[model samples]
Target: MRAADPALDSLQGLALGDAFGDRWFSVPIDELSDALAVRTLRPAPWPWTDDTAMALVLVRHLITWGEVRQDALAGDFAAEYGREYHRDYGPAMHRVLRGIGSGGDWRAITSSQFEGHGSYGNGAAMRVAPLGAWFADDLDETVRQAELQALTTHFHPEAVAGAVAVALAAALAVRTRGRRAPGRAELLTEIAGRLPDSEVRSGLRIAARMPDRTSVRHAAAVLGSGLLISAPDTVPFALWSAAGHLDSLPEAIWHTVAGGGDTDTTCAIAAGVVAARTGLADVPPAWLAAREELPDWVAEVSTSS
Candidate 1:
């Protein structure tokens, strides 16, 4: 595979996982438990949500510029959100992106989120894995670019920390591919070291000590799965899922979905990191076939050398 393949592969995995996880929401509330346990939910043409939509924008921007250019990235994000308005974007994000589309200042609109506390949402982390894969050789650059990308729409320290953690996880997956898989402690510790002191960082510290055999329920209870849709609630568990199932994209995504909250975003985050190393080689053909096609622009980029 080419050096660029990891980023493309991560994008594919993220999108597929996002789409697959979204299908769970369609299941009846009563059947949800059985569906999750038996893995019997088979919804066709699984459409991805805002996770993949924003991720596509980020991937295309990086491919075109060879690095993140914040203003351009923000513009692309706003444009993509406008073009795909039906992709279930959160209300605050919808408002922010719409504001940007109308010629408002992205910095002002983004920083003004949540009464000026800024958004601590996992939106930042959901779209950043491919950036990490693209800059896999430089951990410092990966973290730097992740923060810059997060700042395009998310300004909270916790949100930026979530992006940094996910990006580093992807980068580490790429960096450690074909080597003995890094242990859970090693993965969490390395990611924690790159993060600032915050609740997100504190979560990683806790995650580092979590055993590999810990159940998804227990892990979710401890680390969260974006149940509250905050970065501090999401990034650690997704990373923990990715760390535990580094060599298995399906298993990583399954564990992510089983954890329940914000399933699409969590699965996207975990799948992207896992696929940075494993790629789509082991992904179920049926699942990949069911995912909606990526945007034409990104499809062209993926097929290129």
Candidate 2:
């Protein structure tokens, strides 16, 4: 059953999904690498990666301030990333975050990363659900705030699109709190219409057409399973999993994990979308208990205000 309170549902979904994804990291490197190729998951007690941690940072800001404060958000992300450096963060992100932790100019450090390419990673998308859930009554508000949240780390159009799509999807899901989830086509169309045309949107458009017909392997091949690590490669598969199993949070996470690639992120994204409609019920009790306890600040941020 979906929660009457949108915020808790969003947070729980995001957190559980993130935890599911991080489990990949604990496997022996050879096994983990092999699993990536075969589209398999080792199962739970998954230690969340950068996705959930950064998400917690955003949730804290929203719960405390009720709006995005880019610098503060950035500061919190950098600090958290530094403290938890072993999380599955990207190389570029690790460098930029470390620089920020050392008091370097965030803009200079992040922009200087990836040979000046900046990040086009799905990091922005992984943690944006609370913004969407909190502003479900206003799509424009969700989009606007999502942009603000993304700007702190991801500046590329594709990166922004990933964040926007996640936020939009979450917003739509939240609206389904007391009703049946929208049809797959309707869900995809609503998300695409609200999001500007981009690689992410195009992928989502393709995903909207899939409707659980494709095998997880085929979907990963077509939409990518996060192996490429870019928004275009990651977002589509995640959205497909979400759309295919919109009413079943566990199913969405399972599909995402089965797709392999970036299992954690895909699981996280799917969790966010599915949870919006189904609430925390989608999360398994054992899975929730097994996840590493979030930091005091993270828990506080989610509960603040």
Model 2 error, position 19 (Å): 2.0
Worst 10 residues of 2 by lDDT: 1-10
Report the C-alpha lDDT of model 2 over 72-162, residue by residue, as the tens digit: 8888889888788887788878877887788887777766767776788998998887678878889999999998888778767788899
**Candidate 1, 161-194: lDDT as tens digits:** 9999999999999998898899888999989987
The local distance difference test score of each candidate is: 0.89, 0.78
**Model 1 — TM-score against the truth?**
0.96
Q: What TM-score fits each model?
A: 0.96, 0.88
After the best TM-score superposition of candidate 1, give how far the Cα of residue 186 lies from its true spot, in angstroms: 1.2
